[model samples]
Target: MTAVHLADLLTLGARPAAGLLLSLTDRCPLACAHCSTDSTMASAQSPGGPFRALVSSFTPDCRPELILMSGGEPLLRPALVRELTASAATAGTGAALLTGMFFARGGGRLPPAVRRAVTGLAHLAASLDAEHEREVGRAEVFRALGAALDHVPHASLHLTAVPDAAGHAYLDGVIADVRRRFGTRVPMLVGAVRPTGRAARRVPVHPPAGRGATGRGATAPCEFAHWPVVDQGGTVYACTRQSLLRGGPAPAHLVLGHAARDTWRTLSERTLGDPLLRSVRTLGPVTTRERYGPPPAADGCATRPGTPDPCGSCLALDPATADATARQFATPGGRAVEHTVLALAAARPPHRLAAARGTLPRYADLVELGWTG
Candidate 1:
């Protein structure tokens, strides 16, 4: 098997150079119990100036290939969305939005500039989970879908699920319902729910003892290690989870040395050389036990089958845990490359997963042995 390197993966177009998950604003109208960002009515304020600067700085810094705009609800700042999307497009970046579909129905009453900006986006991704449906309502979901379809030809549906007897059943039904509703018009992606933030507060964190959404009993590998996250405050982290785990700290501004020519180089080097970031770049496949075991108080902490710890497997809210997981998998050898390939390959639409048997085996072999047809 040939080992794939991060550099080669980016150049070959198998992976993006860096995937930027920018939080446009933290204001969402809904107050779902499972909200991962811990967003609420009070925390919905926008970091306008700092966010603008971060986006501006990001454009020239190797220009990430994929930029995902998200927040408590990104539609709140229609104008900013437009500006960010336009900037990304101008810089030749492929952009997407992670939204709750709350604004999709009314076209978000966006300002003229923001509307124009959204129209230019490559795609809009809407969240559809049981909780989302309960809070936002199905009618609103259709309305948002209609709005999105009217604007962007590519709108993806992101479905998050947990592992449990009843939860698994609900997930299966959700997948069916999504297919029945959107069909082939909207692409869909499913993932496990990470325990963190509001979700951690509301939902119990635990891993599925048997076959589960993240490739059955097999652990899902962290492929986002090389990616860097730039928050609204211009604070950069190695990944989104890291940014969240750190409580959203502001990163030091890039430095400029005495030599005029060295200014940009020095700043860029410093940005890339941060120790916290370096730690993230070195993360790898985190053991399930490490994440799920009881807190430090427990003696001989370990996870047992059929006894899932709700806090361990959920990374949706905790940026720090996410960063740690990424760092654990960022091995220098072929392991990281293999893990990434497997992760991407495992990400399939519901139609594919339903039709395909032995997908997990093929994915595992492809990662461990580099098998391809």
Candidate 2:
């Protein structure tokens, strides 16, 4: 089939922007323990220029149907939202925001300009996990949720479920409460803790189990194979996990060409003809066998200095070991590195499925405390 035909099929049941995850900025207001972006805003200030440039590049031909603006907190850069929303609207794409809702409460309301911008978009997703609640304050989150409800009618709440009993309980309560207060209109998406960012240091990483719909249960075919990530640094990758693991190197790391400069034909040829993809198809089952082997020890970088061995649920488990393994895969004959990444992405459950499937009732059972609905 043609590439356009393949892209449409891949996104058949996916939500808006189902194929890509764009990191607008690494900066965030709250220092949540389990952030996937590993964002701290320590990088450059505003991504408006890069984002606008990307939009301009995609206009007329390659505009993505769904665009998600994520960061430390997207609302922190209100102007970026305005620009992004306008660009997406002009390009006939839907726009969404993923944030911590830090500014939603705390006497900080969504500015009228932001509200106007949001009205032009499709959806808004606010994070409300335990760490986010602690950093941004729950009362403020609720207020922010209410405020978001006021402007964006299609707003949804995301509650991250970290490993361990307490984390699970916290997520449960948050979901229940959100459902009670907002009903199904503002659905809740439960995500598992990923081993990236500061969370890699603070939260313990465990073997992927019951992490999400796919992680805990069945392994679905990856839909992200055709979708690519366009990071704020102007780099593109086949997947966000690859971008993070490779530290944003050349597109060759993920076998993707520059989205801004390369034509879709060039990108398709390179991606489909990539040795990495071939190796993955060959070695995926073998690596799957090794993944269930004895877990690594808790010493060294696996556990941050002065911190307890949170390795049980930690994503940084054996960074040295994993790096070594990755190197082996990178070896001339092994190609095991490529297989390992595919295995990880396939193993890790995606929280987006619940949101995409509109399964809010399952999440509502968790957050029962102080539920307003």
Candidate 3:
């Protein structure tokens, strides 16, 4: 099998239903302050049987082009990692893993089990940032990454920015160091860390300017709703807010299906054919609600008061609103409008998409590193 580069993964991620995300486990050894999942060693660990069953169901014709496995830390389940990698390969799907480098904390080298876990992966990515550095030193991560390159055909780094002078400086320093150490051989994907999970209280939230209104009433298309995410317990969600889809019940609009019961084909069909989702992908959450649903209540959002929130709008959608949206998009004009918006969004390069999605505009281009195209 060939290696899948960072650019390829990001491009695939932009297209609807082109990829799949599996949260192998939520348990993480590290206590990164900015962790989006608030994952800890004490986090609930679910059985891997449901995850295996879902991947095993992917046939060559129905498999996603790529599979990205993550968690509080994915390497904790090395044996399962190896198993899923092999399974995906058999169906001609390339698989990748993202780790927090907890295995490299005491490191001179990657643990034998961890090395075995990454053996057949198409790509390997390690998370490095100010918070991660506190638990796992930069030198230890670099050594593990060096050995990782030997096992996987391609590799990259995932960095999160804090959006202040010091935060931006940390990102700049790390980017320079990675380039100096690995040169152009390694690419990177940098995204702004949101005020979610453990970072909620620590990081201040900066709402997008004119977030509810995009000047001409146009909103940035939501690429997050494109790929389906299978949570640790087998429930599948349409967006990146998998945390919301856990515990109690997931929002009806975002719930795709459960992996324990649905196949890749079923999940993909619902993703592409769901009327409410189609509207969200094209018109965005705020626009979708404005155009088809009732107006948002003044007290709709407690966290982001007086702000027009795209996600909150989507979450608060009513059944009547969903029905109205379905009716509107069933027409030829609606279809044409949807196609045009998606085409325009798809034409953008990975770097531009990164910037549009809230990565620091200056460093977004780092994702295109080592790409000839």
Candidate 4:
């Protein structure tokens, strides 16, 4: 109930999914080459009406604790942003926005529409990275953030860097700059560039894995499944990882529900009540397959690290497999493991959770950049 910090949100994965990520629009004015959403002015987007209706369904007792809005650039729909944020307030659900800061390039004061949209929200996050720098000057972005700090309750940066020497140097310098400028008032959520969106074709994408005849043997649970992500089409999926939602028929296991047809209560219940989903959240996809699945096959499912192209082993489920997953995860033993795994993962501070979930190790320490916590 205290003011929320960027570091605090990064750690939400360790707990029951209290957050939902809603992609406002796929249309971005700035074409950052390394973007994970592959957003463009021409890209498809869903209507704001359904999205508004969905958020309108939240009740004080059943709504998500947090709702994070992003897109090719969520600011493109400022009016909807303002509406949804106000609606969230009525339900006691906090709202936040993640933007590319397209409006910040020239470095004057923020446009009235952008300021009005972000006003009274819990937080605002600006995206800065090597790729984004090519489109928007770092100085300009910083200057814009400086101006934005006026209207919002809190402000932060979401930096994306590929892991390497250059990445660390950038993080160190930028973090230092932020510290000097904002002192500890600003916090950051630093992450590595994954093989998603435009980068997928260039950067080889690989999920973490281990070798096994049956995925059931390993205990690596996927906490990412906790936060349900709603794409621009109003379609909701289990994780925020863009790659999982942008293409193909959503692997059956990950599809939650569409915002148009489902209320917050229905979605939240499905998220928390489904045994298969709970298993994936607690035991991870691979181990869920191993525990309740047929012998592991190399069908793009992640296996031992040495195995080539270690993708998620349990991408989807068949009818019989879903049944087994439901039954097995329903048992007392399964419930025990779920609580234990969640407890262990949640035991750390928010920054530590960020470190374990793929933020660069050396610079990972900097994710705790602001806040006394």
Best by TM-score: 3
lDDT of each: 0.48, 0.51, 0.81, 0.74
The TM-score measured for candidate 2 stands at: 0.65
Tell me the lDDT of candidate 4. Answer: 0.74
Clash counts for all predictions:
24, 17, 0, 8
Candidate 4: misplaced stretches above 4 Å? 204-219, 298-305, 308-311
Badly placed stretches (over 4 Å) of model 2 are 1-19, 59-62, 208-226, 246-255, 259-352, 355-373
- Deviation in angstroms for 58 in model 3? 1.0
lDDT of 4 by residue, 280-319 (tens): 7777766666667655565543434434221245555555
Q: Write the per-residue lDDT of candidate 2 for residues 1-373, one digit (tens) a residue.
A: 1111111222322321233455667677667777766667575454366567666554545556666677656666777787867776675666777777666546647657666656665667777777776677776677766776666646666677665678678876776676677665565556666656666676555432111111321123233344556566656565434423344333233536544576434444544444433322333312322342124343422323322222122222233433444555567655554455445543422333333222233453322222232
lDDT accuracy of residue 61 in candidate 1:
49
For residue 195, give model 4's deviation from the true position in Å.
2.1
Which ten contiguous residues of candidate 4 have the minimum total lDDT? Answer: 208-217
For residues 40-149, write the lDDT of model 1, one tens digit per residue.
65774645665455445544545656566788787777788877776666656666677886653443343344346557666666787777777776656756565656
Model 3 earns a TM-score of 0.93
Q: Compute the lDDT of residue 308 as modeled in candidate 4.
A: 22
